[model samples]
Target chain A: MSMGSEKKAKRVRIAPFITILFFLIMGIVGIMTGEVRRVLEQAVQVCLSCIGIG
Target chain B: MEIVRKWIQTIMALLVNGSWSFPFTRTIYQGPLKVVCSPGLNCYSCPASTTYCPIGSLQQLMAGIRIAIENGQNFFGLYVVGTMGVLGGVFGRLICGWACPFGLIQELLHKIPSRKFSIPQKLNYIKYGFLLFFVFLLPLTVVDKFGYGELWFCKYVCPAGTLEAGLPMLMLQPALGQTIGLVFFNKLAILVGFILWSILASRPFCRTTCPLGAFYALFKKLKLVKLRHIEENCTRCEACHSVCPMGVKFNESPENAECISCLKCMDKACKFDAITLEIAGLPMGSRAGARIHRPKQGEVSM
Candidate 1:
């Protein structure tokens, strides 16, 4: 492969870890900010919209 | 390998929907597990689902965004997005291939031994529209007198929700049947339509309509676990295309967005070992790699 193509391959290989890291940090922040509680509150109840009753 | 995949699909389905006490209690599971999101499109309102459906929770958050802002609270659904992102970054559509109960249902429906058909390639773009409009734009923009938006996708579309939650809940609490109106019928019609389409075409919803699948497809090129095609080993036999349930031509484009990394091509079809499963640039295994010790003919008398 040429230098440019090799560099592009390296970026492709590294992109997932970067994406994973960013999301993992966001997820941890969300948990600390009570987003889990929000999801729980909504999910625990029978969502009328989901059942098409809304 | 196919049997193993089927077993995994069955086990994951049961594991996520593990709240088996619903029949006796006549209610959905309301446990702490609901805080976590399942990787697939299983409905949180499903009687036995112990985990939240990411798409449903996302729409709920988007719908409540204005209310949250008015109350001086920031609610971007970071947790839900992050969870989905992490899964997508790691597995891409592998979850759809191996873990999603809805995807499994479609596969089973397609196996009913009828005339199978291929989905139009143009239709694949529709899921992106669903993701953008129903999941994000509508839920965030269209509001009622209370400044609260509606869960447009869940209320109007989402055949998985109808099949997993609506039909079962109605069956369980027949009294709730009276509340059913045009919206319910509309959703039921969509569910029925998708069901018949799934029978005729492999994973029609996944290919053409699932918002979750669209979200994950964004990570196809970046996912850690994926199928890689070695061009040097390929004989251009076109066998992979024939076996792909999602109709992905792996040898030609291993990183195709429609690929679910189910490994059907790698495990069953590729004769020259052109395809291999990779995790973080390392080869996990390949079909030819596994057949190196096969017993020769007439040499199996142990």
Candidate 2:
């Protein structure tokens, strides 16, 4: 297999895991502290703003 | 679909303005337990907010003159900014795009029938200058010996304050009207001007004024959500740029800091299905190259 193919396959799997892991970590922290929860929410808002959803 | 999306955006803003509570809400909702972020950047001290605004909260964080919370140990002014930064850094600019109730008001104003005026290219840079000169430098450097933090925008201007804070407070507590100073009237005039301008333009605030938008724009390259360009299929027509209000050259960099990701231009202009949102479908993945732009050097020094 070529190096490019190996990298693509690895990235595809890792990307989804990374995305999910981020939300999971945020959720756990959000539940623990009011500040963390608010920060996570603000993060979501910032994401939408960059995209013009806010 | 564009109209539909805009309407959906409108409703969401109303809900946030009315219900979503954040730190700023904590300032006004002292009577009963409530949390609500305003639809716009209104001052928490204005006495009219049904909800607290994030920027308003930053100002409120410094409401009293006693800066040393633990007897000169903790710096609240810096902390106020930290609150916004942590929020801005994590979510990027999504708050401005969808959740901000004031943004909703701007969107609705855009629907009003009027001749739209495009801002001159030269004046477009004003937001950045305002960011550096007014927002950070002046506020940080010029301090009142009494220790009350100076909020230039909130105190003398900011229409969001009038609509969300000023008007509401005055109406709710008519007694305040008797003691109103010239500052209230001056700020009201600026707010009214912004309102009138909003009717003729599409989110005048977002386009050239919002400091928060400026911050999130700095993070567009590495934001969690991505707007990808399928280069192989792109016709180089540059339709995206022509339609984009921000004048973003989407073909060169779809995720340019200026890009609000409204996706309207993409939805309307992309006849070739060249721009899309997804995670690793072969056609989409093959287009934008493998390298995601790493977060640049001090792109956001804030």
Candidate 3:
């Protein structure tokens, strides 16, 4: 393969791995920070009530 | 297959927002299922919604973190973000094409007999701006009198919220009429505009301004299930491009972020079996009698 094409292939291969890794790190941080529980607390309620309609 | 997918989307829509009496009760579903994240742009405020809206949860996370920072506390929400990332990595925008109730509504609207118009391809980038500004920046930065940041996208721009949650709330509880203000009317106007626009164009919201759709688009290249182009068999047929609702030139960029994995470009459009759905690198279905080979010039003459 040409150098340019090989470089493109390498980038494509590496992108997903990097993204997955970043997500894994963030997920761990979120759990450690108690963010997951916070989200759960917020999720377990119903407040919109057509008040803001948002 | 498309029909089957449509049915699944409809079923999911019904299943996720299945609380019928919540409208009269004026209470959102507080079931255990609420802890889960909806894979699409569903409004958590909707009485029937069984799960949290990922975009709304993300904005809440940012707002909470900002509040926490102000209070000298370290706080962040991982569940919503993690769920979104995992879902995006696995399915990409397949939710937009196949599972989103709002996307389904737009598709139905586009089917109305009207003079359809194609948007400029460049407009697709606008969703990224919406994602950066409305979903992230504004929600995290803009503060209320109590130093609380509002969910700007949900409060100001989300037509899905207005349609699913707002309308139903008002209809179910006439008492909310007294509290209806200018902001509600403005949102109503926006919803009407989207409804009208959806009729004239295909998936206009998904193409131009859905922050959640934009988020999923980022993971398009990384998703496990994807459309693969069989370059060897391709006859340069532009059928895939023509059928693509998102106007993706699948022949050139099969993994285009705009692609929703609707598979319309597969069985029907690509006559030479050029495009097929694959998990990892392996094709996922029967190949027998599926291909439509276009005859060569010599064969056509003969």
Model 1 lDDT on a 0 to 1 scale: 0.88
Q: List TM-score per model, in order.
A: 0.93, 0.68, 0.88
After TM-score superposition, the amount by which residue B33's alpha carbon in candidate 1 deviates from its true location, in angstroms, is: 0.7
* Superposed Cα deviation of residue B252, candidate 1 (Å): 1.6
lDDT of each residue in B1-302, candidate 1, tens digit only? 88999999999999889999988999999989898789999999999999999999999999999898888767888999999999999999999999999999999999898998998888999999999999999999999999989888899999999999999999899988889999999999999999999999999999999999999999988899988886656667788999998989887888899998888998888766668788876667788454433233433211
Sort order, DockQ high to low:
1, 3, 2
For candidate 2, write residues A1-54 as lDDT tens digits.
267754553453244344435545554443344433232232222111111111
Q: Which candidate is the best by TM-score?
A: 1
CA lDDT of each candidate? 0.88, 0.52, 0.78
Q: TM-score, chain B only, every model?
A: 0.95, 0.75, 0.92
Q: What is the Å distance of residue B100 in model 3 from its true position?
A: 1.0
Q: i-RMS, every candidate? A: 2.4, 11.2, 3.8
Candidate 2 error regions (>4 Å): A1-54, B1-4, B19-28, B31-51, B60-66, B69-91, B278-302
lDDT score at residue B163, model 3, on the 0-100 scale: 91
